[model samples]
Target: MELRHLRYFVAVAEECHFGRAAARLHVTQSTLSTQVKALEREVGGPVFVRTSRRVELTEAGELLLVEARRTLAQADRALDVARQSVRGETGVVRIGFSGIAVLAGTLAADLHHFHRAHPRVELHVTELPPAAQVQGLRDGTLDIGYSPDNGLGDVGDLVVGRGVRTTLSIAVRHDHSLASAASVAPADLEGENLVVYAADEDDDSVLDRLGAEQRARVHRVTGTLGALVLASAGVGVAVVPAATERVGLPDIVYRPLRDMEADVEVVTLSRPDELGGPVRAFVRSWDRAGRLTQS
Candidate 1:
């Protein structure tokens, strides 16, 4: 009838004596007997046979004892798992990133630090365009994302956890005319083919700022690596975050664009009320890294 009833029944069945079972259970013999009687009544049968000298289990008592032990063990395991989840000791974190964001070290370092600190938590990282990252966050395919700060209009349900200022720059072949300059201006690209990641017309992307004539000369590349490969082959110039310089593409030089800057934001789509320990730790680590960079 109740968990305690099952417990008392099992203890009585194991000890086969009223007084010893009562002592083991820390209950009076009368109380234990009463509970066992309640269980037997609930099951519509006598669970024990009593004699003046001893007590022994009936057929139903043996079967019920086995099931009761299993049920209690399962309950204990369930409680342990729930506590672990609450403490952020185990779970999965799915992270999404835009192409240029991966070129930076933020995504890679964050994953490294998070795993080092919480090894039990599984980390899954996916490369996506900024728009696709936002969509993934909205649809629950992603838990967190590193994407350009374009207001996240379509993903209005997502929250911007933190942001870092990223500078846009041009990647050109070493022999290109502008590669020798310390910095370049947007107008310097007037006649050159520009390779960029594809985006929707309504998106507030850096490419949107280029003039109509510059847009006309632009070519859409499939991915970040492709853009760099194209630039290395002298197909066109590639625009990417200043951090991308660390990617170490040989024969390709990275130069800052004087008039353009990009901002990257970390986004979380879950309800604010559900903020958990792991997510908080991740954001704190990100902010600390950003501060170190500024210093």
Candidate 2:
């Protein structure tokens, strides 16, 4: 039967008086009596035993009352959940990120802000390469992403926004020859082996500015932290984003690269029109203009 029928049945059952139930429901006693009669026909039983002086429930009415109350409670909860979802109050937001996004603290800061504001929204974060993040966003597995992938081409209506603006730095051991230098240059790393993150883009990093000989000496590491660990062991001086200074090891000294003019940017990626309510709210939580500036 209709939920309204159950609701009317519950009101009559609770109040046990048609006049009182009508008053509680803000309906005329005649309308309340008509609706209750319709409910009895739908359920094929007499729900109430009417007496001149009193009203009491039939055995069938007692069972229907218990089930009716439970069903109404469940229906109310379902409506509340649907409302909350539509309002961006509860739902899942899947986010993907690249290594530099974490090191730059852009991902963490944005996550914290979103979580504090929408505590009921589930966050599913994965450390994906820029290519994977791009793929996920396009294929509908990810709602939002942070990566160093600048949409050079093939992005197809995906919105790319700046997530970080920082410079590259050299993380070297204390005893390394370039450690004492206040600032470094491509030329300064001429003889030393360099540690760089292996990324989806070809020339997106300091490797593009290095001379052929220094470029030849490059040791590409996949993990950002792996590059630092190797640098701590003197395998090679780590070439990392300037934000790495916050995570500097005791043996590692970071120096800014003076000649690399273009500031490195980690960009955020998302589909234009496919974002869900909670995902859209989570994306808006980021203060994009101020990302990674101090970090």
Candidate 3:
């Protein structure tokens, strides 16, 4: 009838003697016998037959024994899993990010460290735009988000933390003019057509310090990688985070943007309060790995 009754029934069924079952259960013989009798009454059957020398199980008792053992084992396992969750040793952590967030620096290394250390924690990762990531966090669909911190306007309700600091770079076709330059100065891109993010906030980001729009045409795409892909096809030169250098796109060249005083602070966002166990553990692991440096 109850888990405790099942446990008592299991102990009694295993030992087959009132005294031994009571000792195994750390209870008095009378207590064990009374509990089992109560269980038998609840089940509408007798579970045991006792003589002066032996205790034998009824057919009902045999069936209840098998089921009771299984139920108790499952209950024990359930408790173990619950405890593990509370300890942050196991559970799913939904992490949202743009493709470029984990590409270059400390944020990338932090992910590796967290994964290696908490192998049992399921890292359910998704690629989302910064606006979508912000929405996901607010809507409770995502536990953590990595996005360009620039365009997340009025995200003050989210707990934004240092993720990675990245320098700006120009992604151009291999044969495009200035691709061979060691580093391209902002002034040199005066009249060039440029690829930027779909969001106006992103368009008006740190890249605007270059004053590209005063003389250049701007094309907008939904993602940083999309901008680079267009740049590779000579659609336009893309102002991208330095991580684009590692993407290995054919016919694409990355040149550092010189005289750009501002860096893109790719940051992590979460709910404004202390997070759940798994997410908190992951954030702590990131902090412990010393990945908070602004590069």
Candidate 4:
């Protein structure tokens, strides 16, 4: 039977008086009677036994009334969930990030901001390299990506936002000669053994800029802490984002790169049209916090 039929049956069953039920339901007594009669036929039995003094529910009416209320309650909940989803109050957002984002505490901060605002929404966070993050987004496995600006300055398919721009610095042991210098330049890397974190493939560009002899001394590592740990032991100069100064490793001192522009940016990436409302809201939240500049 239609939900309206159940609703009408419920009203009449509760009031126990057809006339009063019709008044409560904003319908005339004759119309209410006709509707109830239609409901009785649909149910293949009498829902009410009417007498001159009052109306009493049949056994089937009592059972149907209980089930009808439960069904109505479930329908209400379904409507509420649908509305909440549309408003971005509930859903899932999958995010992929790199080591630098974690080292800078940017990924954690963004997660806290979004979770506080939408507690019911599920956030799945993953740590991945820049290439993996890009691939995941393209393959529909990830909704958002926090990547370094190695070569993702312009991706034709994905929407990119500049976020957490930082300068490059070289971490060195306290006893290293460049550690005491005012600043280290690209030229200053000449004889130093290089420990580069390939955060966004920028380490490749750094290596390409070096001479053949210097390239032979370059060591590549993927993790931020791994590079810094090596630098602390005097393995080599660790090239990292200047924000790494926050790390406060005693033996490792970060010296800014002279004449170098802002060398690293934690970029925010998303599929332009495929993003759900919650994911877009998450991005907008960061934009409002001034953490991202959308291009």
Best by lDDT: 4
What does candidate 4 score on TM? 0.82
lDDT tens digits by residue: candidate 1, 85-146? 56766777777776666655556767888789888877788877666776776666776777
Report the number of clashing residue pairs per model.
0, 0, 0, 0
Across residues 5-54, which tens digit of lDDT does each residue of candidate 4 receive? 77788888889998889998999899889888898898898988999978
Q: Residue pairs in steric clash, candidate 4?
A: none
lDDT of 4 at 195: 89
Off by over 4 Å in 4: 19-43, 52-54, 103-105, 199-203, 206-213, 287-295
TM-score of each: 0.77, 0.83, 0.89, 0.82
Please give the CA lDDT of all the candidate structures: 0.71, 0.78, 0.79, 0.81
| Model 2 TM-score (2 dp) | 0.83
What TM-score does model 3 achieve against the real structure?
Answer: 0.89
Q: Which stretches of candidate 3 lie over 4 Å from their true place?
A: 105-108, 198-203, 213-216, 290-295
Instruction: Report model 1's TM-score to 2 decimal places.
Output: 0.77
Which one is best on TM-score? Answer: 3
The per-residue C-alpha lDDT of model 3 at residue 54 equals: 71
Ranking 1 against 4 by lDDT, winner = 4
